[model samples]
Target: MAISFNQAFAGHDKMLEFRSERASVLANNIANADTPNYKARDISFDSMFNNEQSKLRLASDNDRHIQGNSTMGESSGLLYRNPSQPSLDGNTVDMQREQAEYAQNSMQFDTSFMFLDRKISGLKKALTGN
Candidate 1:
């Protein structure tokens, strides 16, 4: 059976999705920086990626592994709590830090999108012998 495009790029797609979600979380943190008692939220990409990889490795080791079901383990992607110095009002959201993180995440998101687009374009070319 031929692997579908989604299956082939499942890992990349999940990474992109997580990055996008993380960007949203950072943006929200920045937006709420002025709100009293607002805590900043940030995703731990290393932990998330490692967890996903472990899950995939475990799933692959199963005797009756299913193809499309491998991607179902991506639900562990979520923002982690920050342990940095908090504001006097108990707001952990630092506008400058959040803005920097948001900008970095945006760049990562765009890069991932571009990579996926290029991969898809390459696949199209291969399929069409262009």
Candidate 2:
């Protein structure tokens, strides 16, 4: 019997990719906290999930391909955060907020990594009969 890893993984792989991408975006916001007019950006997991379900899946040649929903003026799940407190230089990134978000994202990433690791370990044990 052929073992389909995709079926076994159950979309956790994609979730991991999304989480990693979000981490990069959050880190960018933190890095540019002092830049004038730099709007803080974020990725919404809920919006991403909704977009995935709402569209027909397609095989794309590149990971950089803009998601299909972007053509319709949808934000493509990348959103500019509204700053709660305005800065003197017109920069929107709040260091404390960004740090908190990055920390939360990091924790979630670790949790997902653990889940994926456990799944792979279970599969390995099943295959080895150990």
- For each candidate, the alpha-carbon lDDT, in order, equals 0.75, 0.86
- Any residue pairs clashing in model 2, and if so which? none
Poorest lDDT segment (10 consecutive residues) of candidate 1: 66-75
- CA shift at 3, candidate 1, in angstroms? 3.2
Pairing residues by index, what is the TM-score of model 2?
Answer: 0.82
Q: Candidate 2 residues 1-80, lDDT tens each? A: 99998989877788799999999999999999989989999999887876666566556899998655434325578888
Off by over 4 Å in 2: 57-74
Best by TM-score: 2
Model 1 ranges off by over 4 Å:
50-84
TM-score of each: 0.72, 0.82
